[model samples]
Target: MRPILRIFLSLTVLLACVMPHAHASVANAPGANLEVALVTYGPGDVYWERFGHDALELRDTVSGEAVNFNYGVFDFNEKNFFLNFARGRMHYLMDAEPTGDEEGYYVQVGRSITRQRLALTPAQAAALRDFLFWNLRPENAGYNYDYYVDNCTTRVRDALDKALGGIIKAHLAAQAGGMSYRQQTDRLMSAQPWLMLLLDLGLGPYADQPMNAWSESFLPYELQANLRRIRVPDGHGGTQPLVQDEQLLSPNRLSVPPAQAPDLRRPLGAAGLAFALLLVATARRARRVHALLATLYLIAAGLAGLLLLVLWTLTSHHSAWANANLLLFSPLAFLLLRTSWRARRGLAPTRFANGVVVLQLLAALAAVLLHLLPGTVQQNQPWILFALPVWLALAWSLRQAAPPASFAGAASARG
Candidate 1:
């Protein structure tokens, strides 16, 4: 295979290898019930034009007057607007900052998705299924720290719990933010049984320790017993924690044992800190390995940006064709730019590297900022989060892509 093909294949293989471990984490959790919500926005002249495309025509439902067809400028803006709104709702649900203007708009919308997900039509369910399948595939989805944090899982679970809909008021009441994270955890104690089970399974690395539900804080532990079936230390000397998977009794599956709820806060937090420190040390030591590290980080950042964009598009319930096209092509171009830069510059590529990393970090922050702005200000404007891809590409390309094979030779030649 060609060198470029080799690089691509290697990355692909690494992802594939890691996914089994990732999915193993999910195995204990109940599969999500497909529930979705579709909301429409009107009363703007430019709304239909921007979002309408490929047989989409906005018409006055009462008068039957056609306003726009196959995506006009207004439709585009409207789509972007709803996405911004949905993002705000997402923030509210997750106990993060809201981006929408009126506090009422954000809260009402969260209530609405919760409501709609409960009372979804067959058509809506089908649309959600299609949307999720296409987007949630390992190739399409990005693995960010948040992915491990379970934002997507939480969002999907919230929607489905609404769909199961026992006491509507009770479910919504349980999900409302503004109370402390601990309050939310107390709610979860009574809220979603599946999530609680998943929390207890300790399938993935995060599960190996106790996670504080309210603050969403992870506390790492010194002792292994507090966690679900961790690889216990053997009496004999061994450096690594041993692998042990002992299944616990379930409330539904077996007789309920009056057991103390595991406090994993310390161990989980410690693990996260350790993992984080390890990365920091690796990065510092691997300054010579900057190119490879940059490449990996770039790929990660690119996928993360794309996933966020897709979620933005879907929640807005707009035609994502244009945005999706941009999403895929943008990263490819960024990679190509990096390849070209590396091919030309030998031994030194620090200027481009600094420019790229700083730019990507800024763009990511900007996306979050835009997500916090009010819906009215964003209604006509395109969501700013999409801009991060450009920075991501630049950073990925500029970072030392590979170790200079002959640093000594280059220095000798210069001498």
Candidate 2:
């Protein structure tokens, strides 16, 4: 159960690219009463749902059968599900179900659902319906899913663009939104500090690229908001809002997701400074205890570096590649583990180990220097504030430090 929970939670957060799809020709859909609407579900309580979800709804008022076409459905029991997800090849599909079937569940969970009546013409509505029905077919339904580029919200946006003759892309694709993928991710993951920190430590420069509105609409809220401002040509002549009417079916029971990223400077900075001070004080008073604590810290740093390294080299997680964090939380830190263990046993750390510490300290210094350079936008200040002081303290303590047992006897030996 724990493993499954971790798999799904990580899966939801590791969001991705557009893949090609096979589509059948548009068939004739029901004539006049085909109503097309966009239904958006707000962020839910579960970690997997922090990003929210959305679907396209096509209703035939004549037949009274309203089907919601959702592209967010994934099967947990699918073969190689975990493996494929780990390799960044997640498979999601469009599911067409009765609209009424989902409302009850969302309402019970206290998640908000908003329905936007679209002003699409009959022809546009019919075309979209045909495409969605075609998508319902087994071969056409499944798609290669990615987080930021090809998730539920992006899929809905693509379909709307197809029906609207590409207006959404044309207007929003190149228009700068002044936000990056990381900023948006930070905002959504703010409530979960651990996840936010995990992502911050792993993500590389790729996540720092600024997003345009089209790319930013991967969020359901962004898509829903953007829909209001879009203008589609009315049947007569003039332009009209793409959203004809808006109705909120249910209210959000959970707190609204934060709009901005959390500022970690104060907390992380204080913690780092305090920890560094503790290490320095312990080095003066209790060399053995300081050695044990530093050894533990080194082991943890090595393991985290290992995970980040694997994500970069062995996996297809593009966002985690080329991370500058390797400087601060390095797998190379493992080299000092044996030295610290020796120190804990009253033996002195080797000169080579002290040299390694100096190298690590220099590398950490370089990380900040490079970030200060122009065009390098990793947004790693929080991590720098947390890691730099520790590395600096470690360097200071490791150099020319007497063995644990020798510290107390040094005064007598000198006498």
Candidate 3:
């Protein structure tokens, strides 16, 4: 009798806990006249926020319950999170939360939000809702995140593509204009000069390759723009626009005017100034100053080369491989450190130093000529302009510091 009563009590508690959620799930089913929207958020001032964000908002008209499915959520407390991020293997998860709560957070942060209601058929909307719920399941929620390929915006684009049965991609393919990954990134980061420079230095030839329409959708704003132009087949031998309506849910209070065209004058001016200083140092026969400058240049080049090597081989940063900047900033420069030390001691230049000077000149020339090669995509002009003069100056300094030919002849004869 005691055991029977205990089992009955446990069964009652389980039913009470499960019943409400079970009822709610049924009430929010896809067939309940769902309204789907693509929610795009404007960029903020922070570095991470520069690319903006996006999510899929699903509202049940019957139950009046709305949920925002965001694909950008990552737990900082997860094991090996930072390690995975550094290795370019970041794992981001889909999080389905109340639409109001998500919108409130973005509103509080001053990020503008625009919602585009998709003109999906009843069957299409139901399928999309079902897919979103399936993706929200714990076993399927997390996905490997790639910034320029499989990011937050791209995920939503893919989800829509799935629901519409390839209509989005077909529409994008028919579009005319296109830009490379680096070019798009540069356009967005133009307002942040320092950040742009950093990204330019880190990115390689792979980033210069032109992006297809699907790839361009990695950007939230680009996805929004492209989606607006997409038309889905209407089954009556005609097509209809994908976006039914658009609404501005929130306005960015800190929005700034669009950035002006990118100007190379700043980089050229800085490089020119550096070249003038190097010329002055050489003309003044400032041995210590020249040696110090050479050391610093060599160190910078070696570090840049090492970083490029790591990006190419050790990490999953696909866009950073095949770097031509390595030609301008070579780790081989480190080999010249011994030569600089010997010259500072008033010793004759080593045969190795003479060889390094020739190699350095050849490397600089090669870097300058890389743009002429067929299918060559990297824009290494900035690096060439900055590094070429320094290399030339270093070569000149080495030549000046070398032992006279007559002295070399006399020493050889004595030997």
Best by TM-score: 2
Ranking by lDDT: 2, 3, 1
* lDDT computed for candidate 3: 0.76
Highest lDDT scorer: 2
lDDT of 2 by residue, 97-199 (tens): 5688767778888889999999888878888876776666666877888888888788899998998889889878867775678887888888887898787
Model 3 lDDT per residue over 85-167, tens place: 87889888777667887789789988899999988887888888778767766678779999888888889999999998998
Least well predicted 10-residue stretch by lDDT in candidate 1? 48-57
Q: What would the TM-score be for candidate 3 when compared with the true structure?
A: 0.86
Misplaced by over 4 Å in model 3 are: 1-27, 30-32, 234-237, 255-273, 276-280, 345-348, 403-415
TM-score of each: 0.26, 0.89, 0.86
Candidate order by decreasing TM-score: 2, 3, 1
TM-score of 2: 0.89
How high is the lDDT of residue 274 in model 3? 83
Better of 1 and 3 by TM-score: 3
- Alpha-carbon shift of residue 330 in model 2 (angstroms): 0.8
Relative to the unseen true structure, what is the Cα RMSD of model 2? 6.6
lDDT of 1 by residue, 1-415 (tens): 0001122322442343246543321111122332222222211112111111111111222332221111011122333545554443211111111112212332332321111112333443344333333333435433221212334333343333343342222323343223222222223332344454222221211222233332131111101122222222233563222212322111121122122333434444454344334334443344435445445545654564454455445543121222321332234334433643353344344565455456545645654555466641211012222234334443443443445567777899999
